[model samples]
Target: MPTETPRPMRRQILTFAVVGVINTATYYGFYLLFLIALPYLGAHVLAFLLSMTGSFFLNARFTYRTRPTWRKFLLFPLTNAANFLITTAGVYVIVGVLHHGSRFAPLGASMAAIPVTFVVSRWIMVPKAGTA
Candidate 1:
């Protein structure tokens, strides 16, 4: 269960969006930094990892208003598993098939994954009220 009654759905969704914007910037920043040395795919993976760590705390503290715990921290990555897979495949297609620049391609790749990520994140973060 969450530490308190969860915020209303509208509010939670809005908060989630706020956190997501912050996470996106963090992800992009790491991606650009890693791109200096790593290949595109490698940069994406490393950046995803780093950004996800920040996302876990932000989503726990703000969006879900829940305390971070070892179990929740461990579980949080699952929320992004689908997102990661979608973006990875999308990135590969965008770069390899579509011949797009790797720099902005991840942003496009990530768009399709957002709804799924939100659902999984809510399920993991809110626990008891997740499915309501």
Candidate 2:
């Protein structure tokens, strides 16, 4: 018997996971740098914005196997907005209500947002056939 092939969704999820690791590393590095000068929340926001920019290109090219376009670049933020909102709220709750350390709050918060972000990003980055 032949081994089963992974479904498109499964493949996408795996790819997204790889890209997410890279994006998270980029974001965390920036966050730590900014943390030296800004509040935790401020650092998170700035880092998120910077990472989302890199994420657009990575997701478009590597994750989705799609060409990068001006249109996709502009729309990419919509996918990230959901992630940003969920992670931001989560960070606030964990750090504020749960009394967690600010340094690790964003990482913990981001885990909850990953599934939602993957779905939204796939929808945005993978366009329908014959559609631009």
**Alpha-carbon runs more than 4 Å astray in model 1:** 1-7
lDDT of 1 by residue, 1-132 (tens): 657644587788898899999999999999999999999999999999999999999999988889999999999999999999999999999999999999999999999999999999989988887656
TM-scores of the models, in the order given: 0.93, 0.89
Q: List the lowest-lDDT window of 10 residues for candidate 2.
A: 123-132
The global Cα lDDT (0 to 1) of model 1 is 0.93
Highest TM-score among the candidates is held by which one? 1
RMSD of each: 4.8, 3.3
User: What is the lDDT, from 0 to 100, of the residue 128 in candidate 1?
Assistant: 89
Model 2 superposed RMSD (Cα): 3.3
lDDT value, residue 26 of candidate 1: 94
